[model samples]
Target chain A: MPTLEDDDLVFRFPQNCGRSTFRIAFQRTLRIPDSDREYPLPPGLGTFPLRHAEDFPALPDRMAARGGVVMPMWQAEALWINCSHAGRDDLPVAVKIAAGKINAVTGEAWRPGLHRDPQDYVVAPDQPWLDGFASAPGQIRQFVAMPLGDGYTAEEQITGQAEWGGLQISVTPMKRAAWDRLRKAWWPGLGERVAYLHDNFDRMSMGLGAGGLMRQRIEEDPHDLADWDQRATERVFVSLVHAAQWSALTGQQPPTAPPSAQAYAKAGLPWFQHYGCDRPALPGASPLRDLFSVAELHKAQTGQVLPGSQDIAAELPVRPFGTRPREVRSPGGW
Target chain B: MQRSAAPSFGTHVRALREARAVEDSRFSLRQVAARCGVTPAYLSRLERDESPPPGAEVLVKLAHELQEDPDVMLAMGGKISDDLRAAILARPRLFADLIRALRDTPEHAVLRILREVRDGDW
Candidate 1:
């Protein structure tokens, strides 16, 4: 008579209504050594206790005495076993399992002891397990067998998942100084590369459009639009730069800048003519006359320090630009 | 068989109350439950189809509150089809993670990506 109290294994199954149902049952006990507080089982062996019924009731009394309960299968959806807390001095922690099955058809109700593994059970591939695996390594391994899914390769399956996955199943200790050094050295370099790509390839060449198209067509097609857009944008920028370089070497109008700079001068910023051409006449009633003064523009355009230029800079408060207060608070303060 | 679509619990409750309007002007279940000195949960359960239909005295009280004939609200409650259970289960989560990912990403980047994606470049 294995009651709920004695159960350490649970099974999850689908009901006729397409809903998940859970079941609880007892499983065999583990004989933990007194010297070793935590035990690490070989890969695949972790799920073995769940497969059998006869082994449940016969589990060692010591394990059952410590409140070793099994988790309900549905709760095992994204299960990660952390052995770090076991047998610490503060208080003895116990592993307890709850058993139940979800109704497969209606996705409702819990039933006692019938569980189905994804391998043995046929579920729509879009189940949460599969969906989650798209961004993470989804692998199940035993000492002898290793199964892999998306985000997993043969080398990763063997080395990352099998050899190291559960071997060091402890919490990682953190050192702030070491972490800061690593972040400073690595992150900025990475950010610089990302920023460069964003400016030159992504923004300048319009690579982002490709990314959007790819996502919209992901289900229908699997192609790298980012690469294509990158190439196209690069070509355009290259051509423009090449034309400018040629003009600089041959002393011709560097087509791209001349037109845009001309437009700016016509619009109002006559100072923009300094880039490659002569300054245009100031417009009537324009603030440029009052702001620049003849001496100021001459000094700015010619790179000579005029006495009046120093006076203007001094009068302008010398504060850096873009430091205006974001919001003005009331005197009383809310 | 293509399952016949059934109304939701809220919809069914509204329909039943409306149908009994002629016979009982104030025939709502809340007033009847109050008059009988019973908690609203009990009346709510009956209206939601979670419990069996109310007794005659409860119905008479409901009819007085609604100001309708006693039998009208009762008849309307009985007209509730049992097929509603399946419809409730058919609704999907609607928005998936992909939509969330799109919404959460920066707008400028999203526009750029969409343009490239639309152009069949990616």
Candidate 2:
């Protein structure tokens, strides 16, 4: 049970074949008031977790005493953008949701008469893991996998991302030692067949191995793409960006003035509470600090905490997934 | 089965049901469903095109309650008679005529033509 906690965030990696867990006790969500729309944190509070289910109770918690290690978090469907035009740390942040980059707020289509591209973004093929999850050959899941407000692949993929001055954030796998610990803990039995068993889309996602061979036999069953949220996508895929190529994915030009700093802040942009954690080496501050914040939170209503507390956090570290994400650069530049 | 897009086989189910109810004020959703031995909710879903039509027996029962042809109801519910479909598929010329009739003629007329073809002199 390697663990780390700060305020309301907690990360737990269990023994037995299971992946590390990254969860938040309290989630910060953005709502445009009366509208039903919600955005994933950029940095959303929790990128969908890559989960595995094994009988950890049967195994010993040997790793519990390994002392917490420093590991990086892998937020699902998120990407990074390094733009000099962004507001200062204290700069105002605002949000403008749109089909492409046009003012979806004002109903002015990005191209006036031109048909808006779907989700206003495209995906790249460089990251092979997405093959299983892409809605089409080289496309990505729209509302389900896309961040609260960014686009994907080809130069056109990120057309509107420049508005927020943040391109889609892509993360590599954890370091070999760190990933090995999770991999072995998660899928100990399968060898190369592990890819088929990897976790994705939180625990909601179904895996081939999860259903065994019978599922694969009927894997081609017709699915209603409209019901995407009902389905689970792959997790290992790493989306890449080729500025020139990325723009090619879209028809409209990336918006000129990204959301004013004020709009970005008002959009309720999420601040990662556990970006860089204090030493996981220590028992972490306080005796029950880990569960203290949870205890203090009002049950609110029965339904919020029912079906078990959604506030439980996964114990994973913030580390480099692959070498590329560490250095932000254009596609081949890395 | 692949979910249909628009105006699938079940497209006309609701309209046909509404027409039946109008013709016979006694024709009610609950009453028709009872004759078919199904819950009104299930029958409502079937009529609204929200559900696939049931087996042949249920289709026949519901058609009888509405005083409509079973084969026509089956087609409106996106269900095709397997024997009839297979027979049409086995012949190129006959299959072409069936396709033309289905596209150009009304369901009642098409069903009549198909039956006459199946039962009449070659």
Candidate 3:
């Protein structure tokens, strides 16, 4: 089971699994223009607040059935999944993130089991954060929210149905033997990792859809399929209610919308791009590729322009950091 | 139900150790005690709050075995880390004034101070 410690959803594995834990946070970020221009990663404004679905009275039936946690988001708001681990940052935890039952990485229908050939899941610590759908090699379209049943959602667009309107995440950790081998081979005397910070919505149920593409890479799975503990997987379904609905249901005001791409650029805030190792990125998912941006879909369906669909400014300054070495393939410092 | 009283340092330690042991046999109290070079009986007493917090050196060992930050373990045990103490002593008046001045400040304010110092964002 995943627990909401502060604002982070923490999934802790059983003791036999070395007490491996993964922390996931929903980060508020700029909703880049849904135009043809791909943009650099926007700064994380803050985390969205989360509450236990069970804590509130009279939850929507689907949300009650899911029974994990609920968070509110403004329609068209963009978010990124921040991934980290307690105890060890390098802990190998495989995470499969799906929005409305559509696989965020593979752009395939949701499946209970992990996959490798196309690498349907991302490994935490190595991958760090996921900004959006895996659109192209080393590139992703950002995760933007839209109301369900609106053709804007990946669920409705791909599945021809909008049955699920929230996010589903399942995590699997590395097998003990594989983890021990890596730990011993790597930094044997490594110090404890500083824990990641936990930091926080609306009333309508929303689903994630592809937005502007960004320069982000979902790292190739560095470990073999056998290295993952498939039998011991934990899954959680996150219900994203509309921010206005958030105030109505939870009696708390939802967070204000994030700054526009123009406002962010005007402030000259630093945009980030992590420099990673030479591990090749997975080829873009076919189904996720060629999907219409929310604005384009809205325009096509309604013959009306989507609000906030203006083109993003070009030449947003990019600050490169984190020269990450490939930890898996590196030989022993022991 | 809300806990009536905050757990004592020993109760906290015992609970943390036992919980980890229950999930993983490698963390069984005796195993942890052995790893930390303490007797199982003494460790049990420590958990029961019958004994005072262990010395800093012993607490460090326990912290490492328990996968907890040594500084946190020291603080929970009502002790200051030796290095932190030395640092404080290095600038006795400055740190003394700083701690006293910030005594009643809110946590967020303290965090802001820390961020400013760490980032040199003056």
Question: Considering every candidate listed, which one attains the maximal DockQ?
Answer: 3
Q: For candidate 3, write residues B61-105 as lDDT tens digits.
A: 888677676888898888998778998999999999999999778
| DockQ, all candidates in order | 0.02, 0.00, 0.03
TM-score (second chain) of model 3: 0.83
The residue ranges of model 2 lying beyond 4 angstroms of the native Cα positions read A1-334, B1-11, B23-25, B89-122
Please give the distance, in angstroms, between residue A112's alpha carbon in candidate 3 and its true position after superposition: 1.0
- The digit string of per-residue lDDT tens for model 2 on A99-186 reads 2222221223233111122222111111111111122221122111112122221111323222211111111112334434434654
TM-score of each: 0.13, 0.20, 0.69
Docking class of 3: incorrect
Q: For candidate 1, write residues A58-100 as lDDT tens digits.
A: 3223222222221211101112221211010111111111101
Model 2 per-residue lDDT at A256? 18
Worst 10 residues of 1 chain A by lDDT: A207-216
What CA RMSD would you report for each candidate?
32.4, 27.0, 15.4
Candidate 1 regions off by >4 Å?
Answer: A1-59, A65-141, A144-168, A191-334, B1-122
lDDT of 2 at A23: 22
Docking class of 2: incorrect
Clash count per candidate:
69, 56, 15
lDDT of every model, 2 decimals: 0.23, 0.28, 0.77
Query: What are the chain A TM-scores of the candidates, in order?
Result: 0.15, 0.17, 0.89
